[model samples]
Target: AQSVTQLDSQVPVFEEAPVELRCNYSSSVSVYLFWYVQYPNQGLQLLLKYLSGSTLVKSINGFEAEFNKSQTSFHLRKPSVHISDTAEYFCAVRGSGGSNYKLTFGKGTLLTVNP
Candidate 1:
């Protein structure tokens, strides 16, 4: 499967802060970019996707990411964040080699929002 890897470590700070999570990926054929956020016990939400159109995309919760073709990676970043943003973030890609639509996620990023 097309693989995506996020390099963001542990992001920790006070409530209502700004944060950025970096992500990278490798693919031989065409691919789609995706960002998902995982809450405490929830699965994940479709933050955004870069299919075959724009290079810059944003989510409903103020999170955004850019697709870099040269670097072969997609990075997520936000200027201001909230306690609700505390969760695990993942970067994924769908390989165009075949009909497989499985996503290869990164190790995961932990965003800790403290009061």
Candidate 2:
């Protein structure tokens, strides 16, 4: 089983500033990490993921995360932010075996990008 931890419950950043959302996880088995964003009154949308290939993964909206197995961390970062980027961000992990496709998520970080 895997569990995710989001260090910060809330992050406030000014528009056009750089930001990073810290995330850590613990698991006994191989796991896949993902970041999802949830806007007000909307379902979660996949932001980025680290499954295979390069340890570094990025999303279309300029968010990137690096999978550091040693530290058991997968922190999300963006060079710049926008007010429209404000949302609840969740870090999730799922075991990579059997029929267990359940994703364990963190408490979530509410990113408030102010104008």
Candidate 3:
């Protein structure tokens, strides 16, 4: 079984400042990865994902996450953030193969962007 751990529960950053939310997973086998974001009262949205090929995946909203197999991590980063970027981010992992649609998610990290 694989489990994801988000190192920080909350990250506060000033507007236009860079931010990095750390995420780590523990698994002996191959897996698919994803990062989901929730804004305010809205539902969860897929920010980015990594299944195969490239280790780096970017979202349309300037957010990016790099899958590092060696360190078993998929950390999300952004060069600059806005006040609208305040939201809760979740790191999810799903085991490769089978028809399992279940995803193990981390506790989540709340990113609060300030001016």
Using TM-score, give the best candidate's number: 2
Q: What is the C-alpha lDDT of each candidate?
A: 0.84, 0.95, 0.95
Better of 1 and 3 by lDDT: 3
Q: Which residue ranges in model 1 land beyond 4 Å of their true spot?
A: none
Give per-candidate clash totals.
0, 0, 0
Q: 22-70 in candidate 3: lDDT tens per residue?
A: 9999986799999999988899999999999999999999999999999
For residue 69, what is the lDDT in candidate 2? 95
Tens digit of per-residue lDDT, candidate 2, span 39-110: 999999999988878999999999999999999999999999999999999999998878779899999999
Question: Which residue pairs collide in model 2, if any?
Answer: none
Please give each candidate's TM-score: 0.90, 0.97, 0.96
Stretches off by above 4 angstroms in model 2 are: none
Q: Cα miss at 46, model 3 (Å)?
A: 0.6
Candidate numbers sorted by TM-score from highest down? 2, 3, 1
Supply the global lDDT for candidate 2.
0.95
| Backbone-clash count (model 3) | 0
lDDT, residue 35, candidate 1 = 89
